[model samples]
Target: MHRLQPLANGLRTDHPVPGIPFVDDSHIPIDDPAAIEAVICREGGASMGRWERMNEAQGAWLAYTADPLRPELAWAVRHHPEHGRTVLLLLTKDAPLWHSSWRGPKLLFRQGGYWWDGTTWYRPDQAWDATCKHFSLRPVPDATTITAADILDENARTDGGRLLDVYRFDPEAKPPDSWNEHLAMWASQRAADARPLSQCVVRLSAPELPADQLIGVPKMPNIGDIVAPTLRTYIARIQRELPAGDG
Candidate 1:
């Protein structure tokens, strides 16, 4: 039996929902977006006249790669009619997804930039305050505790080398066997909770909002600041690995 391994940060490894068959390498969704893109691009090269092909080739060279075979992989493909594009998404199984709920009439945490609602990331600024309430997920309604995991799935993977703090749920109890099913049910709720972007608000985050609201805002360190503590720890590790004098 496959068991979840605990990480140092307290999040458990994302384990697949029991009994879901692992997709074999030979059956890696040939009709998927990546394969389709490759086929279309290759055919376009063959069909076009030499001179015309050169111009088209520039745009057609968009490349995509598949993830290595893993039993834990779960994915979804989405098509955006407005953008005329297909998006491939990977998701984790039995992971503690973030979601928000209303608590009375007030919108809580206005300063929070991004709120994860287990399904998709939501920008609260796009929402009308009166229409929403506090941002909280009822992971297991009525349950005293819940389990949380590091969401390293495709749609919600992290690259900062820093895993988020483990959000503890009821760790003692086993989740419902149909946990994935529960996630699907939550999807529609999240959609209903979402507010369309205002006509005047083309940008998701604005200066009127908190500083953290602005994605990609660089941290401006004080003049007195030194190297980050994490970097110092890495230096110590390197010294230990090197010859005494060389370090």
Candidate 2:
């Protein structure tokens, strides 16, 4: 039984999407670009690296985290004067994920995962805007392709902190089952209509497991439901993003 706990200033906590934490948010500052940049940068802290600004329009600036996770992953913030708050948008490289129609839990391929539109948490396919008919995809600028770092992340592990025996290599060094189950519970969909974030193993940054572990990447499924298009578009975008054999 998971739920999104609301914060004081009309904001809420992010779902513990696998591999990520129950990360908090900072308020949208003054309308200046520098202000927005400073907030995102400060919030990201040491866990995240430099961010690459992709595009800005409609008072929203889209920037991708230079961290090795992927190029398609980025955060967009738009200031709505009426609301007096800027909307923090977590968008994939494709169309605003809500428009992608892939309404499932977060996956390694379709990482739109889940988003909170200041009021409601929306699945990839759950969002609809009467005002804007076609939500066009953002243009990805030419930049160096980002990937996970070769060295282990300073704070990558979600597994309860346990010192390992350096003498031997054990890939499946098990953590307490309750620990896994506890995070597993939070990882799923929180709302009554939303289901748990099951189906895929924690992949990026070794979400559920330790970095020393060796688990293969989740396969990009070729078929999905009508409202849920397959990861073909996801992979296609990645291919477009990377040079010839880079992806």
Candidate 3:
């Protein structure tokens, strides 16, 4: 039997239904009779069912990655009052093309919110918007290769060269306590350079595969299935640091 874990911060009510162990404000509550019945009538089950179905559809893709790029996914997990969890899923047409044959697809996911109540996710209205602003994405011209250095170089050559900034990806792992420090450094440098940290534009290092030769359209996985373990880990870490309550 699965055990329902306690929420670190008192953000969610701890209510458990068999099969679905982690029930809290992060999910649409099942206790409301009207909402429950509505869900059942329309979708046959509640949020868990919906999650499962979504997971199945998303999991079919050959390459799928998810991050809190969109407000919906973040809102789902953060349970922010003003802003909903927004998520973005990227599905690759084929294996990521890397400049170095030794380098493979390296996907990284990050979670963010305005307030961390030591356990649960929270955000003031202003804070929520500010956070959302940082999580925006922009399109770039399709190319065969892209690197942080290349972006900086492009900006240097452009008319708005002064507006450019340099961003670097950390390859080494660090302790949890150092995360904020690293982020602060990165943010400070970017700010000093006057560039907004935005979505990464991926470039292919090889020719595109013909559509006829490709398999089914790649799909992205739902947040629940793709990062449930990470979510649970975050929940546990918050519980350890904050007051005990259902999250």
Candidate 4:
């Protein structure tokens, strides 16, 4: 959102929610939630959400935000208390948007995620070619009402079968499973007459969306490299924006 200046450009925040105006650059401590830290939750701007360790004995830390201004979606992050990479999740309460896309798509977890274009629901891997720089993804859904519980839901899934999507160029394959499978199945049907794999376009299935009713994820504008100076500016903005707490 232009309301927030450089933050609207992803050049200003460490975590930028792609479609929404929210961005979080808060420096939450990994070792202890109670430790002195900088938390930025501006009323009209960026928010990191209320955070705490998900489990005791130094387990995963979580940050969750349920923006009242935008009720259709929620944002969360899960990372080990120490030495763990953060995983960002964008959760939605929009049934029409979620149901229109292919279900059971996996991201870093089993049985989660969705992929969609303007018209069709495509699996993640087969959704793009080697040429894709940015692709569409919906990480979690099925929340009737989003709250702190949504972040808890993300950590509850099995960490197995991490299938975002698969590539299938095989010609003699069985019936189609996904976009990749559909392509191969089409090629196998043609046998010798089929065009080269590079030239083929998937017919796309479960066509359930014009997606006009879905939440608008504003396309990200490239703000160039996030160097030290920009980051310092980011932190300063957070400090400058959020109202200081009572001592």
Report the number of the highest-TM-score candidate.
2
- lDDT, residue 244, candidate 1: 11
lDDT of 3: 0.21
Alpha carbon lDDT at 181, candidate 4: 30
- Residue 81 shift from truth in candidate 3, angstroms: 34
Q: Model 2, 1-247: lDDT tens per residue?
A: 0111100110121222222222223333323545434433334364222222222223433222211232233333333222122222232333233222212221112133223232223232334455786332222222121122222243444444222221221212221233333343333323453322332222223233233543211211212221112223433445322111000
Ranking of predictions according to TM-score: 2, 4, 1, 3
lDDT of 4 by residue, 1-247 (tens): 0111111101111222222222222332333333311233456755434555444224545444433333333333333423232223233232122122212221111101222222233333324335766344432232121112222232343232122211211111221223233222222333363233332221222233223432211211123333422332343355332111000
List candidate 3 stretches off by more than 4 Å.
1-145, 154-201, 209-247
lDDT of each: 0.22, 0.26, 0.21, 0.27
Tens digits of per-residue lDDT for model 1, 1-247 = 0011111111111212221111222232322445523322223453110110111222221112222232232222222212111111122231111001211111111112332222232443333345466334322222111111221222432222222211322212222333333322222222332322121011122334443433210111122243222222332344222111000
Cα deviation of 183, candidate 1, in Å: 30
Give the range where candidate 1 is weakest over 10 consecutive residues by summed lDDT. Answer: 1-10
Which residue pairs in model 4 clash with each other? 19-217
Candidate 1 collision pairs: 98-117, 98-118, 99-117, 145-170, 146-169, 146-170, 147-169
For all the candidates, what are their Cα RMSDs to the real structure? Answer: 22.4, 16.5, 22.4, 21.1
Per-residue lDDT over 99-165 for candidate 3, one digit per residue giving the tens place of the 0 to 100 score: 1110111121111111222122222112223665632222112313222333343223222111111
Clashing pairs in 2: 19-207, 68-147, 68-148, 188-197
Error of 4 at 129 (Å): 45
Residue 91, model 2: lDDT of 24
